[model samples]
Target: MNSFDKLYYENYHKVYRVALKMSGNAQNAMDIVQEVFLSLFDKLENGGEIIYPGTWLYKVTVNKCCDGLRKQMRFATLDVAAGNEFHEVTIEKQETRQIIEKALFELHPRERVIMVLYSEGFSYKEISEASGVKFQSVGKTISRILEKLEKKLKGLNNDLY
Candidate 1:
């Protein structure tokens, strides 16, 4: 197998999932993943030095995700807030997930990307590298985003009952 093929096999899912979480849609995630691979191929052909393909893939995926988010903002997101209430707690939990997801969508694209990457177990240093942000900025950004998500989720949970 070619180097690109091996890289694709090992990291495609990671790239796609990061894209999905950042973009907040499965379809957009798939598109971003394809775009990332295409860009990788182009770079390879141009003799670009890729010391760490995984990191490069993530950077490309994030850039595509941000691009998609910008395009999406031209249209309004679906009102996921409008829904029926459930008597069962489990069903209520599902609805809470939906609400939290909606709140996540409302975050700034960069904050959303940081939170999603951090959630996926990427280190602050790795997130810094992938996002092209300074190492010190990673901690502050992540802290702010996580705090925002927590507050939003708490409010959403209160509203659900």
Candidate 2:
């Protein structure tokens, strides 16, 4: 396989997982992944060079997910203004994954992205680069997010019990 094909193979799943965590929807994650790769392809086609493809992909994927969330919020706001009643879909009881996902879903988009990137084992520098957060603040921000997640998870567990 060619170099670009090799790069795509190496990073596709990583990018998809990040997108999925950031967007909280499989379909939206798939679309974001496609858009990210398409952007890389376009840049390469036009003679752009990427020194670190993995880092570049992570940044682009995060950006695309954030953009998608912003657009969704706009429409959701409009729907709310129209007096639409939103229904809460019941999830299966006691599923750990669902509970964690629910907690993560409650986080701000940026916080979610930071937590996802950190969980993926990226160093503080990588997280900062991908998330646009300052390097010095990554650890502190992570600590805050962890506290929020822990509290949210405890609350969810209490609800279940």
Candidate 3:
């Protein structure tokens, strides 16, 4: 197999899992993985070399996920602002996930992506490259986003009262 093929095979699962966790849905995860590979194919076709295939795939996957979330947010915002009610589930764990997802869903796409990538063990520099943000801004954003998440999670716990 060629280098691109080999890299794809080796890192496909890692990228997919990251996508799945980011998306919280299997279908979207599959779509992001496919999109990443398709982008990889185009890069290889154009003779672009991947010195770090794993990192490249992670970035692509994160980009696909952020794009999907942006589209969803647009639709959701319109629906909510139109006074259309959503039928959200109310189970305990599901409620917790919803609260977390709601806060995550409210963040700027890049911030949300960075938080997830950071949680998955990527350093600030890695997150900056993956999320296409300035490297210098990563630390500030990570600190701010974590503070916001903590506050939101605490608010969620209170809401359960």
On lDDT, the stronger of 1 and 3 is: 1
lDDT of 1: 0.80
Worst 10 residues of 3 by lDDT: 75-84
Instruction: List candidate 2 stretches off by more than 4 Å.
Output: 74-93, 159-161
lDDT of each: 0.80, 0.80, 0.77
Tens digit per residue, CA lDDT, model 1, 1-161: 98779988899899988987886567767888888998988888898889988888888888888887788774235334334554445766776778778888888887777877888999988999888889988988877787888888777677754
lDDT of 2 by residue, 1-161 (tens): 97678888899999999987787667777888899999998888899999999889999998888778777773111111111232333334325556777777777788888999998999999999999999999999999999898888888787554
- Provide the global lDDT of candidate 3 against the true structure: 0.77
Candidate 3 regions with alpha-carbon error over 4 angstroms: 74-98, 159-161
- Residue 154 lDDT in model 1? 79
| Sequence-dependent TM-score of model 2 | 0.81
2 or 3: which has the higher lDDT? 2
Best candidate, lDDT-wise? 2
Worst 10-residue lDDT window for candidate 2 reads 75-84
lDDT (tens digit, per residue) of candidate 3 on 117-139: 88789887888878887999988
